[model samples]
Target chain A: MPMNEIWNRRLKKYQSMLLRYSKYILNDHFVLALLFFAGGLGLAYSNFVRNLPQKAFWWEQPILIIILFLLLHVGKLASLLEEADKIFLLPKDYQMKDYLKLALKHSTLVSCATQLICMLVLAPFILRGLQWSFGMWCTLLVVQCLLKLSCLTLVVTSAYDTNVKQFLQQFCFRLTLLIVLAVGLYLNLILSLLFSLILAVVTNYFFNKASQRHVFKWNDVVVYEKGRLMTLYRFINMFTDVPQIVGQTKRRKIFDFLLRSTSGNIYLFLYSRSFIRQSSFSGLFLRLLFLAGIIIFFSPNYLFSLLIACLFLYLIGIQLFGLYLTFEDNVFTHIYPIDESQQSFAFKKLLRKILLLAWIILNVIAVAKPLFKVEYLLIPVISLGEIYLITGIFLRNYIKKNT
Target chain B: MTLKINGLVGGYSRIPVLKDISFEVNSGQLVGLIGLNGAGKSTTINHIIGLLEPQKGNITIDDIKLKDNPKAYKGKLAYMPEMPVLYQELTLKEHLELTIMAYNLDPADTWKRANELLKTFRLDNKLDWFPANFSKGMRQKVMIVCAFMTKAQVYVIDEPFLGLDPLATRDLLNLVDTEKKRGAAILMSTHVLSTAQEYCDYFVLLHQGKIRAQGDLEELRSIFNDKQASLTDIYLGMTQDGHANE
Candidate 1:
């Protein structure tokens, strides 16, 4: 393929991947657009409100801003290509130098533009507030952008060697840039420009060296990339929702009590059995505990406590419902000679058991903690009631839809 | 005891993948389930093992209905899926240990059989290795060893030989033969009809969610006059009837 065609195809593939992977988090186009607009407004507000960097600590504000901006983008670009490095980019091992060149070119332009935008808009007000000369500030701004780009090049190029090392280096580089900008502020303009030139030369040297270092081996990179993606995927899978892998892990022998033979309903036993094996549900349970803990520590009034409790109940209901939806697609259930009505009943009973367990635990904690007012006992009671009501309605609709 | 099914209609969800599926496996009989891709062979076996619910009918193995007593019913049968289903966290020995615990097998017997299976499959060196590290063939061997170690009354295996090397496949086939001689009923699904022809005592041909034909090799061949055909030939002949006309 022609180089232009390959680059186009690569860009399309990356765009599609980003879109698909962001689906669970983004939900809809309107939400995405709103989020972007909100983010822009938030940034503008923060910049306007903060009155820019106002310290007399011998450092130019514009230079500091440029340094911080560049460092942030460097880290992002490094992590972004980390996945590509694992699967497609690093695999053509012989031509990695060429790929690194492309990556560096992309990262430099992106980092420079982002830093320039932030510094140009935010710096003048801040520099003026700090009473710096415009001519000196302009010189520092240009030099700082170069410093930022250089630091980015150094950090991102070396990321292929080790993510941990690259991440730490990016952080360390920010600190170094701050020190350099401080020195430039104290030194004469001639000395600052000379120092900036030296720093640029040194960064270029490291970037070239790091780019040639083909450190990501094939299988290792693939596994690392998979692990990284799965972490992000698992997080997104928690919110909105995705089909979580319902893998069964042998629980501790103590929890084996739950698996004990119950002569009552065979379907109930199976349903409970499957529910306990839903690994991600444990995370939701932990989230509830943390949320409850925060409410205990932080909520000031009874109404605040009640609202948080209601939110907790909503989480509980959704987790329980999600478990059913997930296991409903379970291949084992499909293959097993279970009765439809029996399976549905078992699922409901299992949900009730889990909900009851959560209710008991949360109520015990809430009532015992004196941080809660006597009226706060009403929170757990009301929360459980809300959960039961919501789950009951959802279950009725879900069953009707399935049937 | 024999596993008997009068009319087994089942599949994934309400979508019926196995329609009016019925089969019986007496103790000591080796039954091969043959089908092309998407032929409902796995669906049928899954229903028999009690992993799937029957949409319209019932299945009984060893005189115990899966719906009536899943725990007891599941204890009597061991299932091996097409892919080696394993916990990456568990070592090979731990996989066997968990299966033994699930089935409530005698500890001594479990250990002895697991060791023997490892030796037989030439995987004794890998007892401590996590399944995540195993190759595709090795993983299949682990699944085979775990199933055979259970020593269940019935074995329902789907495409058991997909990634197995020739030696491992031979060992698996021989293990199946030995299990049959010991009066254990076996239901195996595979697209490799030639291997099934050689090893299976009876054949069940599934096509498009229905049982197209089933019988002994000679009986299956008898469907076509004076044709002493192989099992694959008969299966192909039966499946092609409509296609040939079209």
Candidate 2:
């Protein structure tokens, strides 16, 4: 069997997964929010651009170069290589080079597309702030895409040459990309484009040499692909559940003080520690809390702020309902002599505590704003009532339904 | 008898894996549960720990059924599963603390015993580390420490010696001995026949979810008509006969 066919199969499956999840990600409310946000930002950006100084600002070139450099790091080589592929495809080691070529081609297309979109966003600033001609802007875009290509090539090359110092290799590639872009923005645009093309060629040549010199490092390549996919899945997990992204854990030693009061209670002890350390739960909580906080802080009316606060509180409450089942499969949870009723009670207590904190922070932000109308008092009161509704009848119904 | 299962019939689902299984572990006794793969050892342990309900019969601790008083029944028992299941987010210290609270043991006294066990297992320094991130052997050690730390009246340890090192193996045996002398009833399921032969006071050999023979070593040797046979030889002989007819 040809390796290209295998690569094709994986790529198709990966794209289909992304397509299915995109429906969840770009749902109606999210799209509406995005439209409003983008429209508001665009209006502000155009206004700022219209009022630009007659001459180039001193930091314009530096800022443009830095922003453009950061955008280049947006994408990487999507190998679409699963862990099982190493074992199942071991006999096709001779055909791996061909498989990798297909992977590189797909990665280059994706990275270039991302670069193009980012360049389009920066078009107004580049064209107006720096007073560049369309031709020059297009040339800079080409230079950015080429730099991205160079980055992707270096990644693919490292997969073959496993002996190299990975950190140094990546650092040097980044440095080269920075220097090349800095030249394009600061000096001759056409000359920098030439340098970027050369960099891409040199990296591709190194990839050829590495692949020729080394045998197929199946484990390293699979690990590299998994790391890249996990990063993507983590980003998607912010929107909806991605079963592939197991929540990561961190020992936030500073948060020990917050867990002190939960000493005697078994479920509270487990739930609180899990919320703080497991990235998925805490990350979702903070994201919704602050996202709603920002939107409320800038709301034109108290009603909108209240709506946003209530909506996010519901979202966070429902999202964290998952934490209840985290220990369901562990036999110790069942075997522990603690009363089974204590689990639901302890979980509700924890949820109330979490939602109450969000309520206080959101209300504080809402009240701290300069609005002093007596009706404005209703924001905190209504949201306080929302907290009760969520913790009282809402949580009970949820527990009943789920259990 | 401190722990007793009377004519227990249970499995994961409708079809039973353990059939008419009856056993008793008296106080201050160690019963080695001998079985091959899929020999219903885990199913028995599960029933004792109340993860699986007995389809037909009942399991009781100190003559009290789990159905009658679950809190008291579970409070009197400690279980160490063959595969260690740990909360990925909890520290080793938190795990031990959770166990103490779960069993409602006195923290002051339990912590003292827990500290000794931790040092014995060389996990004293890793209290703040997540035991889930530990090596297989160290995780098994954490399970051991958690189970024995409860100082419960009856302990159900499943394949307890699978991943332990030689030094840890010795330490575990000594710990078990101490617990036994304190009148704890231990029912251990393991494949290490030699160690079981040396330490266990009784043997319950199970084949295909049914007890073929059970007694002390000499009694087992007499049943097989081989007075000089080690437990391993007797076990092999048991399994060979189990497949001979099939």
Candidate 3:
């Protein structure tokens, strides 16, 4: 079992899995919407940058560099260790260091690519704000690579000693690196390069020492890997059904009142209760509602607000359709004597109520603003129409296609 | 009323696992469906419960076919599966209420019976509790209560003793006997040979997707020509002989 071989195999496996799911996630509609969003933001950003003041402030450059460094800190080292590895690979524990080192290298490479992309996205801002030479930008990339490696090493160290003291130490170390890099990049590139070299040496020393002193905490590693995998699965679940993702539920006793009044139909009872209790559906509903409320509150015109509200209602309706399949595999559902049409009817009824509730809240928010005018009354009228269309026509088409 | 399976040939996929399996349970009869793992006991139950459609057969409860009238067919039978299928969101009381609603049972009578059944199963205190935190045995008890709460003509129970404690198992057996006395037909599948032998009025020994033998204890013993054999002995002999023949 060579270490690089294991790393390559695991990397390929995860990459392929991610690619397979991402195809579903990055569909044409989503990509088009994303492109429109990015184009809008890009236009705004360029306009803002073009109208910038002539005087370049000292702190702005450092702050921007520090923000870029922080953005690069988003990823974790992909150990790619499954739960079963503990049993299957425990006999090879002594040789686990090579495997871990390979893991570190692979994680750093992946994170470096991510950081490069982020830097590229921010390159215009960096170039315009600081007036830095291209060579200096290259130097910054090198320093970023160093900082990313240090962060990766610290992640490994924290896995070994996940205590308050280790956390504080890592926090202070990262803060120090941020400040040193910021000051060095601002004052002198040579100094920053020298300091980053020292930091890299120190990071490697600690990484090697920790690796030697501590055996692999298989539980922590497995949990970390599972968390990483679940994050991807959860994201993919938002777009399409990820069969591997298990939904979480919350008690949410505050919402129990909504279920106190039942329709005497079991499907209605079940679907309504599931909507309030299951976090997957309920969380999406609340999140979309919150976003809709915010957009409706801040919209410049009544038409825009109405459009935003209706769009969110449509999204909520579409996303909440996943709830219909929640109990598909349960045998009791098949054995229940309820009419087949009752399930669809109950689901539509539940969604209509939920969408109406969202509509009411958004309308209230729209009306409560001090800028409310006579035309604002039409917001609710338009929202009502949208809700009916979404819950009736759109849901019918969705159910027809899915069933 | 009788729950009859004329010729159930079905499985999870296109390939048939149950090969023309046939059985019947008349009113007040408890017929034990016994088999080894992957011996088509679950497939047979799945077909009868209408989860898996039969490729070449028909199942009828009191002359109501599942395909023709699923509502009527499902209304007559209550199933307690091996693994308890419970809603994580619904409380124990809500589960009973939902079952009553699904079956259209009389609220007053069903609620009274439900309360007594909950008390008998020692789940009265947990009426408002959801199944999220329940132990395996407690979940099984919940399913048991829900199934028995609906006074259907036929009870299609699959491996009801898997996760039950001794007291719960005893209570379940008592409930089944009570249901039998109330003139309901029960088709129960179990690996607990002694319990099945003692409680079942008739036994259907399934081996490899086919019925090896089906009869009362005396008939089973006579079929194997073992006058002194117990139900377990007869079952063992049948399965071993099945292997020998294969």
Candidate 4:
């Protein structure tokens, strides 16, 4: 059994899974909402960029270096190793270097593409804000791609050498990356490009030597692979149910006081505790709220702010409808002595309160923007009305369809 | 004060798993529903707990059917499932709270009972932690505490001794004994023939969805015509004789 066949089969299956979930991710409504969000941000960004003084702000180069450096650390090594491989592939340990070489090559291709696209997006600011030459911008792109290659090498190196010091792999590697990126933006592009080239070469060479020196760290590698897979699954989970990812529970003891005030209604107690303690539910609510808050905070005009706020309210309400079925499989829910209709009513009450909180936060941001006017009072009035629609009709339809 | 299942035919799907099952667990009686794996013990229990609707016949508690009055029927029953079904986001204490809230028990009163049971199981100190993350035995203890704390008239417990330690198992049996004295009707299913032989007032030996033999220990031995046979031997004998007849 050649490992190449194994890698190809896994990559194919992995890709198809993503492709299947991508349809749900980019549904028309979500895409439209994302476009509106991006358009609003773009307007604000261009406005800010146009108004920039002829001289760069003192923090401009440092901020650019930080952004690009963080982007360099975006993608991880996708080993695709499963827990069963420890036993089944144990006899093939000698060939693991070849298998990992394939993994490294695949990761480099994906990550370099990511670096290239991000550099393209940041190209405008690099060109105008920093006033760099086209040649220097191209050099920075090359340096980003090279640095990303180095990042993958560092990750792969840790797989072969479990005893690799955290200081060496994590801190020093990141410190060197920051320094190189800072030098590239602040001092000279060619020198920084030269440094990253050497860094990438050294790390890849170290990977080969370590692979020869050490046995395959099967447990560590499998755990690393699972971590990477879970990260992907967690992201996709934001859009739809990913069975591979389980929602984790946190104690959240500080919110215990909130429970004291809640009545002893079965669904009310269950839903509130579920929302606050499960990372998936509360994380979704907060992530959407934060995104919408930022969008509305920079909303170019009153009408756009109103549009964005209402759109996000609807999105958050729909996403949270999943909470209703959280206890669907629990035997106690079916066996409990509570009235059946109370479940829906309690769910609606919680949903209304949550959306209304979003409404206040968003409307405050929209109205509190720099160009406030009395006429903008209509925004709050209309959004107050939007909350009722989302919590009432929108939620009703969502619940009806899902159930 | 009686739990009755008469001609109860049901399963997860249209095809019935429990066929013509009839039994009565009257007040103060501990009925051991003994069975092998896949012997429809759980299906029968699911029917009793109102999780599965009847395909043909009816299940009633004191002449009150689940379909006729679900709240009143369920309010009188407490179920401890084989696999612990816990709220992932709930703490150990919150599980008690949820139970009390769902059952409409006075929290002030149930909490006192819950603390004593929790102490008996050595789970009193785990109140603030999430029981969903507990060890298997610990989770089973949490389930026991919740079910017994409910103090309902009818207790339906399934395979409660699987993961419990000797001490916890003894504590559980003692709790069941006390509940029986207090007039709770318990219908427990288990493969632990030894314990069931001693504690259960009556036995309903289920084999392949049908009651093969049901009696007290002496009666079960007499049915097999072996006066000295243990419950395990009697059960194995009954199931084997069933296969021979088939």
Candidate 5:
């Protein structure tokens, strides 16, 4: 019942969940690969910057400043109130003000940290382009923190007013404030500080007015919290299994033809339909495949492109393994008289056909592009090997472990 | 056909929730599984459907043990869960089609029966509609249609009348009657004692994971020492007696 105890409990729960997934995300191989990628990009960026002319371009400072101002809008208030809290904590609703105060503090602090990091990242660009005084830079940081606080307040107040018209009105108001700050900063430091103070007062007024007018919309808060958690879970899902996230489905009738041809075996029909209709697995597959194709199309090295293609194929395979557990809780699946092994066979068959299609698409793209010519024939050959290895061996082990 | 459960003992974990439960559903018999919350009705059904392995017992459908030949045993029976468990992706027609394929039912005959069931349930116009769009009653109706279409030797339905409309409930009872006339065995669990007493040929009263009493209406009334007691009266009397014993 102590508000701080509840806050600490939620914080610890979320922290541990994030830590658990972060361990998987920060795996040695992945971290090293990321470092190499970042290092390569950094080198390219530094070379580009060094080769630049002495005078700063007219648009560079405005563009970077606008981007920094826009970044402040991305922060959300994490209330951490779950759907069940509506029923359980409804009696103690008045006491929730203290809880929400803590939530706001937590959200503001977290947003401030992100905003600081963004400023840090943009520091070199700002210094290179604007040539501002250190005191001015310090003033800019202060204005950004105040702007971020306003944005967070706006996000919280907006949750109370779920009407689309009111939401857009609030959004435009915030946008106007952002633009004012950006333009004021461009013109003079004193004007920007004055604009920030006005924005802070406006934000406080809006927050107070909204809180007084509306009792907390439990559904809106729960939905906002769920959406935030789902986004985190989705990101973590890429690195490791996160069972908390519920997948969505889409009726992709265009791909229904692929399933239509397969009949008689219910497992085949089920798996195929699930693969095409379930948005999470199919969406992940398509996104990864599209990314691979883009990367392959751009990369001048044919072998490296093929490697990227194979890597995506492996990712698709691993990701689709989640589909195996799709019907785990559906008792009808367990009640069905079909042989259990048939499910694995059907899943592998579906994967094989999908991977083959991806391989064909990638091969066609690779051949069509004139980036690298001689090793074009090798694309299919390598892809076929990777596909077989992934589907035949890796998938077999994955199914073994998951099942 | 007879669905026989003998000396069944099982629960979610090591602690047994159903203890030494025994029952049988013979051909043309509709056996109602009556129980309160936490009375092991679902666990008993789970064990019968092979979702939970009994700690010590055998469930045989028409002399075929589930462990001995799972496919054949499972094929012989159809199960409708308390809550409708449907695929979000599959449409009504596709659900029926998939059930047909899984049960290896004759396509033409089963499809005809499915169409009739769909029409009876007023879902004929929503063949292409997915379960996501179906209401609670409609979802339950879909499960009913799928199960009825299977035409298995035994049907194990749990709480079938929960969300059904009166018309759908009557239609379901009619369908069960038809199936019963065709010599299929049914073991249904329900809290609707009036409907159960009206339709069920026999009743198994479960209390605290054990069958406290089981018989037809007249027999149950006699057991409770009341010659003209309704099913509700018998049930209440049995439970109060259980409380007194406790």
Candidate 6:
């Protein structure tokens, strides 16, 4: 096939995949909008970083940024891998080489678009601090990105080929790049250019070799890709903005004691059990624990107290909402003749109790930290929030009941 | 009390799998629902169990409308899905405990019946085993034990014979007999018409998502003019007639 035709075909394939993804990743239109808004906010944040004084080393901020990107990278890879495994499109393998070439192009475009955007946003501060010209910075940034792309490509190829040598090659190249980058930053512009050129050439050589060495192992590719996608999916799910796949897992048995004394309807009993057993709900608990851990670690002073409380409550709120949605999946529930009105009511009560318990535990822990004071005012606010949540749940249930 | 479903129209999605399905099983009877693959036999059970909503009509169990009051109706019925739905995290005991909790049986009765069921189903040795390690037959037995544990007013069982050993099947049949004598209705769906023939007091032959014929063995026998003929013979004749129409 002609290059244009291949490109068109590949584009069509990607568009279809994106359409399927829109069902989960972009299932809620508001979430899609939030992702865009987050991207914009990210750009603005990056711009702000660039405007920071050159002397401001900003190690913590940059480290945090890298960690954020790492999480997102893992998530994106996981989602991609998951989709690839769903249906192998094995018939398309008749022209496997062409398809792979097109796929490599597609992967490169996506990877570069994201990395370049970040590099560009950080370019001003980075260039000024390093005493480099705009042209030099752009060149270095482009070359650095190519190296990053090559490393990613190498990982993908190695994972596909089941090649041990690629792992060694990847580790060696990354180490070399890091050493050269550190030296070049302190050295002359020409030295930096030389280093970038060397890195880029080495990256290109390895990437080309890796790409050419491909032996198609469909299941290996699918599994590796799925593993990657699931990791990212799990991370992206943490954000209120991103709609990631919420998988079911078996819940711990410690909560069964609560199920013993059942006063509510039978549906309530079943719903409560589901709430406790469902993986999605447990994930909410973990997320709250994680958020709490982070807050404790930071320990921002009293001036930022309310803001911290607001953030804590917000995170808890998201967790509670996740608990509600855990039962909403069309798995066993849809097939069972469950009374929707009763289910909703039961779910509301169950969630309210859970939220109250979680809040008390988390709040008490937070206040125990010497840096933070326990404010009586926020307790009422929190109580009111819980009440409101319960009320809203019932109201939503009524709407569903009526509809 | 009898379980009755009339004009049940529903399926997975817009593709209607079950069409105007209606059937009945009086208390103290072992009823078999037989059909070919994709014959909507399971769909009928789903409607009766209150799983799938009838786009066109309603179901009543013991004169209680399923649509009007599902929890009450559901309380009277215990369903065993085609493929057993077991909680992997839960042990066999936990599974029974959860069921007992859902059914809201008296604590004493729950424990008493649970122990009796465990012994009867030969799951006494596997009380602590997680269902993840259990074989297919064992899983089916677990589901059966859970349903039978409830000893509800009615049992809507789907494909109970799929993964059962001969002994387990015999035990299940015996259990069904016991439930029947206790005035509890049993509505079972299966493709093994012959296996069901000996136990089922009545048979409802579903073809292409509709009930073709239903009655005691004599009534079904006269319809095919195959007196002393097995249910397999009658079912084959009915389906041949159904296909000829199609």
With candidate 3 superimposed using the best TM-score fit, by how many Å does residue A214's alpha carbon deviate from the native?
A: 6.4
State which candidate, 2 or 6, has the greater lDDT. 2
Looking at model 3 chain A, which ten-residue stretch has the lowest summed lDDT? A28-37
True contacts kept of each: 0.11, 0.93, 0.89, 0.91, 0.89, 0.24
**Pairing residues by index, what is the TM-score of model 5?**
0.93
What is the CAPRI rating of model 6's predicted complex? acceptable
lDDT per residue (tens digit) for residues B129-173 in model 3: 887579999999998999999988999999999888999999999
Off by over 4 Å in 1: A2-75, A78-231, A243-302, A316-321, A324-330, A333-403, B1-24, B34-77, B87-134, B149-151, B165-171, B191-198, B203-246
Q: Interface RMSD (Å) of model 2?
A: 0.9
Q: In candidate 5, which residue ranges exceed 4 Å CA deviation?
A: A2-4, A161-164, A294-307, A361-370, A375-380, B13-15
Estimate, for each residue in A31-141, the C-alpha lDDT of model 1 and write its tens digit.
543354456566765766466445554544465555554454442332333445455554466565554456556656766677667667656554655666777767766
Model 5 lDDT per residue over A1-403, tens place: 7887898899889788778779898973435534645665677667766665667777876777678768877667888888899999878665665777678889889988888888886776666556666777778877888778877777676656434487677768767666766665568877887787788788778776766655777787789888888777776776677787555767776776677777956778888888888766676778777867876776557776777777777777777788878888888888888898888888888889988988888887887797447877787798899988988988889878877
Interface DockQ of each model: 0.21, 0.76, 0.68, 0.75, 0.78, 0.29
lDDT tens per residue, model 5, B20-79: 889899999999999899999999999899888989888898889988898999999899
Q: What's the TM-score of chain B for every model shown?
A: 0.95, 0.98, 0.98, 0.98, 0.98, 0.95
Colliding pairs, model 6: A74-A232, A75-A232, A78-A228, A78-A229, A79-A229, A81-A225, A337-B50
Give the Å shift of residue B7 in candidate 6: 8.2
TM-scores of all predicted structures: 0.65, 0.92, 0.87, 0.92, 0.93, 0.73
lDDT of 6 by residue, A274-322 (tens): 5666555556566655655455334445323334444455455544554
Please give the clash total of every predicted structure, in order: 11, 0, 0, 0, 0, 7
**TM-score of candidate 1 against the unseen true structure:** 0.65
Residue B176 of model 5: what lDDT? 98
- Error at B199, model 2, angstroms: 2.2
